[model samples]
Every structure is written in C-alpha cells, then in structure tokens.
Target chain A: MASNVSTKNTNNSNKNGSSSNSVISKLKNTFGLQQLIILIVLFLIYGLFAALSPAFRSGSTLTSIFDASYYVGFLALGVTFVIITAGIDLSIGTSMMCAAITGGVVYNQLHAPLWVALLVILAMATAVGCLNGFLVAKLKLPSFIATLGTMMITRGLSSILSNVQTETFPLRGTSDGWYKSIFRTSGDFPTGAIVLIGVAILCAIILNKTRTGRYIFAIGSNREATRLSGVNVVRSEAMAYIIAGFCAGLAGIAYAATYTTIMPGSGAGFEMDGIAAVVVGGTSLAGGVGSILGTLIGTFIMTVLKVGLPYLNLQPHYQIFITGFVVILAVYADIYRNRKKNQ
Target chain B: MKKKILFGTIFAALLLLVGCSGGNSSSSSKSSGGNSKNIEVVAKGFQHDFWKAVQSGAKQAAKEQGVTMNFVGPKDETAIAEQLEMLNNAVNKKPGAIALAALDTKAEIDAIKTAQEKGIPIIGFDSGVPNAPKGAVKATASTDNYKAGGIAAQHAYDAIKARIDSSATPPRIGIVSQEVNSLSISQRTGGFIDKMVQLLEANPKIGKGKVAVTGHDKFKNKVNASSAKAIIELRVPADVTDAAGKTEASALLKKNDTICVYGSNEFGAKAIINADDSVGGRIGNTEGKVVAVGFDSGKLQINAIKSDKFLGSVTQNPIKIGYEAVSLAVKAAKGQKVKNIDTGVKWYNKDNVDSKEIKPLLYQ
Candidate 1:
C-alpha cells in the first residue's frame, strides 16, 4: 500500500515535470488552459451583454447573475466529484429539489424549527447520494441507469411529499428568514458569492490535499489496479457519491433561500446545467482529472449566459441555442488541446 | 456477489416504478368504475395551489352531479409530450366526456381529433384550444383572461395616473409576465399593454408624447415604443421559474422613472413582490411609491396586497372554471346543448379581498 501511494505521487510529479518543460505547457499545467479559456469567455459574454443593454451593466443585474449561480454552483461543485470518478449523477438536480421540498414541508406543514428542517434537507440529499454510490460502487450498475432511476424516484417523491403544492420558504423580512442571509443580505449585497467562494476553497483543499481525494483520483484512473493494490476502492468511490449528495443538500438550501417557491418535477433539466458546468470547467467526463475552481468558473459562465441573454434583447430560446454552441465549442477545445498534447 | 447486488438494486427500482404506476392506476380505476358516469379531466399540471383548487372544484361537481371525475395532470406544465400521452389515455378509456386545460393549444389538436373520432366530447377549460379541429370541442369554461388583464390595467392606471399627470419626465410602467408562449399569459399581458396604451392615447396630456411599449419582441410589436411619454416595458422571463421572473422584475424595477409594475401570473406576482422586498421600495399610490398590480391569488400575493406592498391584483375564478368545466362536460355527455361559460374574474384589493364575492375564489 505504501509503495503504491509513493508510486502514484511519483507518476503525478513526472507528468507535471513534462508538462512544465515549455512556457505554454507550463501555463497550461499551472492554471489549467481550459479553465483560463472559459474564464476569458465568461468575461467576454459579460462584456457583450453590457455593451448591448445599459440595464445589463448595473449592479442589480450582477446581483441577479450571482443569485442564479448559487444552486447550480453547489450542484456543479458536488457533481464534480462524481464526474471526476468517471461516474454520472443524473439524480443531483431532482435530488436537490426533493431535499428542498422535504425541508419546506418540515418547516411549513410539520412546523419544525428552521435548523431541524435545514438538517433534514442535508440528510435527505446525503442518503440519496449514498444510494447512488451503493448501486454503482457495490452493485456495479451503470452510473447512468442507477442515477436515472433515482432521479425519477426523487422527483416523484418530491411531488408526493409536498402534495403537488408549491412550497415556499420564509421571506427575507420574516422572523425565520435569517437563512436567506446565507445567500443574500437584506441590503441586497451578493453575500452568497462569499459563501460560494468559501465552500469552493474548502472543496479544493479536500480534493487536492486529502488522502481520500488521492484515493478518489486513483480509483477513477484505474479501479482494477487500485483494488489490486489493496485500496478500499468501493469505499473511496462511495465516498465520492456521498460528497456529491451532501453538496446537493447544500444546493437545496440555497435554492430554497434564493427562490420564492419550490415546484415538484420542475428540476429535471437542471442536472444538465450542472454537468455542462463541470464539462465547461475542464472536468473530464471520463474522470481522473478535475478541480473545484474550474467547476466554479464554469457555473458562472452558465449563469452569465442565462441572465445576460435577456439584456441583449434576445429571446430565451436564443440563450438555449447559444449555450448549446458554447458547450460544443468548449468540448472541442478540450479535444484539440488533448490532441496537441499527445503530439 | 456483485451480480446479486446489481440485480437487487434493479429489482428495487423496478418495484418503486411499479408501486407508483400501481397507485395511479388504482385511483384512476376507482374513479372510473361503478354506476356513475366517468369523466376524465386532464389538467396542465398539479404544480400550483390553483390546480388543486380546480381539482377540488371538479370533485365537488362530480359528487353533486352523480358523475365520477378522474383528474390527471403531468408533473409539470412544460411536459407537453406527457400531457399528450395523458390525453390519449383518457380517450382510450372512452370516458363519457373529457375536460382538458390544454398546455399547448396547437399541440393538442390531434388529441382533440382523436377524441372526436372516438365519440368522446371534449370540453376545454382554463385555456381553450382555439384551433382544435372543427366540431371537436363542445364548449369552453374559462375566465376572460384578456378582460381580466384589462381590469388589472384599469385599476393600475387609476392608481398611477395621478403620478403620470404630475411627473415632468416620461414615467415607466413595467409588466412582468411568466412566459410569452402560453396563450393565457400572452392575452393577460397583451390586454394590460393594450389597455394602458389606449388609456394613454385617450388622454390629451399623455398623448402629447408618444407611448412606447418595449420588452419581449412579441409584445414590442404590439405597441409603439418610439418617442414615448409613458414607456410600457413588458418583461417575460426565459422560463416559468421564480428565479427567472425575479431577474426580469428586478431589471424593470431598477429604473428610477418607473411608476407602476404589473405581474401577469402567480409566478410573476411573487417575483415582483420579491424584487420589491430586495430593492426596498414602497409599492402603493402614495407619492414616491411605485404601484405594483398583480394577477392571481396566492398566500404571498394576498398578503402583499393586504399589506399594501401591492396596489391590487386580478384574481381568476379557477374553482368556478373547474366546476363549470365538469358540469358542462357532464351535460354534453348527456347530449344536452351546452354553451361556452365565462367563469369570470375579480380585481381584488385589500378592501375587496375578503368580500363575499371574492372570498371563495381566492385559493389559499
């Protein structure tokens, strides 16, 4: 086991050394060329919208952009782990919504305290993630099929739990509305930005500096080899799913805080947004390579497109069309870079 | 061991799916069986309290009329394909009659035709399918959405007209609609914009300057937006979520010259109220307050109206619409001559919200 760990470290360092031999490759290795390019694209989109509509240039518009990012950001951050392990979680979107709906029911119908309700949201999401992990890690089911079933289950459960009613959280001025401050201040400052950044940094540390993180990367790179080396590959892979689930829980809370109402079966397409963010942020769907920072940047790029398109006097359908093109372009860029690197 | 666990997980998932579908089928069967005539009512979705109230009303009508009403809806309003499938299923059941709140007017034409071929009379409710095949639809029970929007506009204009007269600069009126694609929302928004423009054009003082209506392209072409005195800005979000609506509301609220705002639906109303809360502005007819008028009645919108956070709102008669739809369907099933019914709408302010006429129509 000790030799395996040392050998993995040496392999990582050797790759780093080779990539740093050229100035361009050094920049690519250090900052991640894909993330840098996406960041540039984010700024360009912002600039384009600002140029098109004077209303888009205001602080409120920026606040709206930040507000839209919270739930998607957390979902992207969590699912980055699953994707990093060469796994998919189609359930995250609906799971987050289901968790939020559960919390809403607890708070509104059951008259539970806000803290208990928040914890319930986290617990529900974590259990779902564990289920996904158990199905994939232990049962060896395809991640796609496992999460797809879980997605339908969670969505259906959410509708059943809320009785098909739109569950609303406490508004900002209400006594129990302090939770809204976690995402935005009463004064309308983007306090959620600070929380998102803090969470991103914490996730970065866990992904880069922790033993569990190393094992996760190892399992993703080669599950068979890692298991042969006597690592607990199942547990490590399951832990990745658990982390994804926990992140989804946090996203549920963010969603409840940011929006006025939670509707059942409304979150079906949201996972695609999170997955797109992960991909755009330079996270490989094949796994073994990803960063929390890249996912964060990717999430902002998506929100900017969603919130910015209206300012350009473009219809909402145009935003969807442009987003499709953007995803294709980003993935193409990734493919091009990989080919160049191999050559 | 791995194979066993995999099979177990698959089995569990299958069990869950079977359980859900089983529940649906049993409930539907319970409604369909017995001596009572079964009438399947397909709704847009049960996503809102409005729909639940509609379902309750339908149930009430079914109990009173000695008929069995089977209500089913897609999980969300955007599930057009799912809704089509539900309509097909309702037709396959060959129910006495089918009452539908079609999500897409044109998309359901084929289903309407199918019901026609199957000799199942179709009654349209909430939103009528205007372009359905000839003789396919027997009657429609719906609130006059266009007139309801005009009522909202009339009340809003009454509140803000004083401000319009006093202000030297061209004041702005903002309309936040949930979406432009839905016929119900389009009519509501169009009615408001048209009424506001007509009112402005009638007044010589306001008519001195041009009235420009700008926002979504479909609405922009409906009114003049160039060289305007009162700029009627119509904003519809990309989607039907509160997040999208709130973004549009906040943008409309940012302009200092804006005097009044109208939210065309429940989602839009909540979005306006939310934007107002975040932006911290008075929403009333008093000096320096922006008049906020809304449509539909939800707890949030009702409370906002009661608290003076909103000027007023146009409340749709969803329950009556539901009852009337089922009643008409039952009558049509009996081969009785039935005509279109206007369930009507009421403009409820804080004073009239609890009034005898408006109290029962308010869903929560």
Candidate 2:
C-alpha cells in the first residue's frame, strides 16, 4: 500500500512536470475540461434563450441569473471541500434554511443588527457542519445518513423557527442596511458574479495552497492510510465540515439579500444541484480528485440548463427527467474514470 | 464538543447583536397611529403576482384605515400546513385582526375558530374556509371561481360555434385542473364542465355525449386505476387550458385528438403553453390544433396568448378581492357589520387584453 501511494505521488509530480507550460496546463491548473464544458454550456444556453425570448439577454435577466446563482454558488463552494474528501453534505440546503430563519428571527423579528444576524447564520451553519463531521469522522457514521438526518432535522427546525413563511427583513430603508448592495451586482454584471469570482479565487487558493486543503485531498484519497500516517483524521474531517457550514451561512445571507425574503422552504432540493455541478465538472464522487474551477463551471452549466430549458418551450416536468439523466451519466462517467486512474 | 457548542453559542450571540443593530437603525419615527396596533395578513406563498396584488390592496385599505399591516406566507404555494401553523402563531400575538388566504379549507377551521374565540376575527381572502364556525370572520371577498370556469366554457363554445360549421363534426372538449382538492380550482373546472355539458345537451352534436370530464371525477370513478390507461384514454380539450391540470391534459391531448383543452389554473395553463411547440394531431375536425384557454398570468401563457397559441382566459379581480377582503376585515374587526363582498371574474381576450379591467389581473 505504501509503495502504491509513493508511486501515485511520483506519477502526479511527473504529470505536473510534463505539462507545466502549455495553455492546457493553465486550463487544467484552473478547472480543466469541466470548466470548459461549463463555459460552452453557458454560452450555448445564453444564445438559445436569447433567440427564443428577447428578454433573456437583457441586463436584468443576467442580473437575475446572478442573483439566483449567488446562494447556490456559495453552497456549492462550501460543499466542494466536503466532496473532495469523498463525503457528501446533504444538510446544506436545510442548514441554509435554518441559518436564514435564525438570522431573520434574530434580526428582523427581534430587531437585531445586520452583523448579529449574519453571525447567527454563520455560527449556526458552522455548528451544524461540526455535528455532521462528528457523526461521520468520530462516530464512524456514513456521510449519507449523517447528513440526511441533519438535513431533515434542520429543515424541521427551520419551519419551526420561522413557522413557515417568507420573513421580510422589515428594514425597508436604513443606511447601514445591507439590503441595497449586500453582495450586489453593479452595472451590467451582478455583484453576485463578483462574489462568485472571489469565492472561486479563495477556494482555488485553499485547495491549491493550504496544508488543510492538501490534507483534505490526502484523506479523500485514502482515509485509513492518512490515519496510519499520523494525521488527525477527525480534525481534518471536522475542518471540512466547518468550512462547509460557513459557506452555507454565507449562502443563506446572499440568498436573503438577493431574494429580499427568507422563506423556510426557499432552498428546497438544491443540494442535488451542487453535487451535480461538482460531479459534472469532473469532480469524482469517490473523493480526493476534484477542482473548485470544475465545480464553478459545473454550477454554471446547471444554472444555464435550469434557466434555458424552460425558454425552449419545454414543459417544467421534463426538467426532472433531464436532471435525473445527467446525474446518472455523471456518476457512471466518474466511476469509469476513477477505474481507469486505478489501473 | 464543548468548544464547538461554546463557539456556536457565541456566534449565535453575535448574530443577535448584528440583528439588533440592523433593527435599531431601521426603527420608524413617524407613528401616525399606524404602528400602534399591528394588523397581520397571512397569505399563501407569493410565487405569483396574485398574492402581491392582494397584499397591495390590503395595504392600501390598511393605510386608509390607519393601521400597520405586515404580510407573510410560506414559500411553497401548496404548503397549507405551514400556513395553519403561522395562523396559530399570529393568534398568540393578539393582532387587531387576521386576514388570511387559507392553504387548506378544512384544516384551518380549528385555527380560525381559535382566533374567533379570542375575538381576533379571521377574514379570508382569495381562498376561504367556508365552514369557519359562525362569525369566525365577518365575510369572505373572493372571485366566484366556478362561474369563472363556466364563463371560460361559454367563451370557448362561442368561439368554436362562430368558427366551426355545426354540420361538420362536433368538436370534443377536455378539462384539466391543478389539484383535485383546490375548491376554487375544482369549482372553476366544474363550471366549465357544466357549461360544456349544457352546450352538448342543447346541440346534441359535440362528440355525441362521449366527451368525458376526466379529472378528479374520472380518477375517483376508476377501480384499480392505471395511470397509463388514464393518460391514453382521457380526452382533454386543449393544449394549455389554465386553472391547473393543463399540463397533464395537454400532454395527453398530443397523443389523443383533443380539439379544445382547458387548464383549470395558472400551472395547468403553463403546461399547455409550454407544450405548444411539440403538439400535433386534431381532435375531431379541429385540425389536430387544440385551441387552449388558460387561467392566471404566466410568462408562457402571456406569450402564448399573444402568439395565438391559446385563445384567452378568465381574469379574476385579485386586487379588488384583496382590497375588499382587507376593507371588510378592518370594518368587522372594529365592531361594524360587513356583508360578504363579491369581486367578480371577467372573460379576457386579446381585444380587451390591454384594457385596465383585464390588465391588473393578468399574470403578465
């Protein structure tokens, strides 16, 4: 096993050495083929929608897309770390709901400040992530069941917390109020895109540069092996969750800002889209081998598909079939590619 | 674990601080007796412009009445259970009065009764709890949805009669509704079916009385129902007939020859309009082209109607309903007797589409 690990490391270094200068290296270094696919898909979707509906290419439309993308994007980014470790966090969607409602209840209904509301969101999300990590890393619970339970609990709590309704911030006009431009897009581009870009850059830095990031990849590659090598498996897993929760909190805030209302049921069934983006963008669900760049492009592609399909006069029901097909195709491709890598 | 809990608690505290600060800066200075007594209007989700229009009307009435109004609803339109829970919470606050768009007709009775017991009158808007004890709230102000459906059928028959020769094959019609249980939706569909049946009986010609009203009734009648058989055998009237049930019926119409498709709600209408590009075949001598009419205002429905994919639809005065509901609620809450207010529905077509009467109610 040690020899195999050493050989795999040597091959990774050797491959990195061979294609160090080409544009291909730059693309691979950033996001790789998945990013390219995402870009192509986004453009194709834009063109198709633009042709079908004249309003599709308008600045407002683009802004709306950016607005829609912000929360989902943040959720995707947070989960990217968790995914890279071959773990899934199904709780992000409900966790987002809990955070948003907690913030809304604290800030809006209770008349709290913006910072306090935001802190509550982040703190709630982080804590949930920690709990998720505890079950998975320490108690040895399967990631699926742990997160699923958390998802159900969080969803119930969100509904309980807000009592099921879109809670308005009650801050119609305040100078310090972040409503006007909290993670906003300006001019032709939404500020959400800028935030997405910022997050992408930060995630890239973390995945590519940080020790914790490296440890995440190592753990993803082989958990037991990393543990045998004297790494704190529990700590690394917990960190991944903490990061995931923080991203969810950020997403909750961005969602509240963009939509201007936090509905407990707002982020329903959105986690699958994040997982789909990551997987479609070349992140293997098997863990250890994924890129934030790929995930961004994947998200872009999914978003495009979501927005563009309806404009083509396709029934909304058909989207379910399309999404299901894409998910199956992605998982199959991942398994195939991972098998090839092993051989 | 303790450290995580401590961090979570501290973070929660910080959130409280941020929330408090944001709230403090936004406090209103102009009381004007509006903020003195808060009036809560609980709506069913605001996905469509209908609820927003209702809120606006309610707000206008509230402002005139010197009351502060707050609007709230679940995100998903169909989540009635959530709305019920919200009503309970609102009752605890002891607001001046509660105006609601009940998600569930029967489940809300208990809550409405509780509000009544507390002297917090619950006036329903858009949707009502018909059996909310006695004087649970003075009266309901909403569109006569059933008559609206009948009105749609009348328009469809008029259009068909004017266009088609009576000597030719009688054009068969189909109806689709969004939900089997939605009282308003079902009533509208029933009205349409009733009108269509009347037309068929009077003429003794359309489909020789074989035009099956395949919706809730058909499903209920079925013994060990096969969805496939239902899909294949059910004859819908048009591609996108609004009010709901339009999508499923539209898809079924494509497979079968349906001349006129009727959707019972906005979702049903959207389903038909959405299937416009891919639809084919004729029901009887209608050229395999099923003339569709929809309910509510959706981007797809608007575009389709503009492009002639659908003929037109019945328009409900949702804003007026909203305005009247709030006005009535406020009056009743203040110990004044207010009778049931009727915000009528009207037939809308391309000719009068831009008119003020039809414009406000259209789903854009």
Give the per-residue lDDT digits (tens) of candidate 2, residues B54-107.
777877887787765656676567655446545654564456677887765454
Clashing pairs in 1: B212-B224, B212-B225
Query: Per-prediction TM-score, please?
Result: 0.50, 0.50
Q: Write the per-residue lDDT of candidate 1 for residues B228-252, one digit (tens) a residue.
A: 7778998878877878888889998
In candidate 1 the C-alpha lDDT for residue A312 amounts to 35
lDDT of each: 0.78, 0.66
Stretches of candidate 1 off by over 4 Å are A1-31, A340-343, B1-364
Query: Per-residue lDDT of A18-92 in model 1, one digit per residue for the tens?
Result: 544464344334344345556776676677556544545667577778878998899999998888788999999
Worst 10 residues of 2 chain B by lDDT: B223-232
Q: Candidate 2: where is the Cα deviation over 4 Å?
A: A1-31, A163-166, A171-177, A185-189, B1-364
Worst 10 residues of 1 chain A by lDDT: A1-10
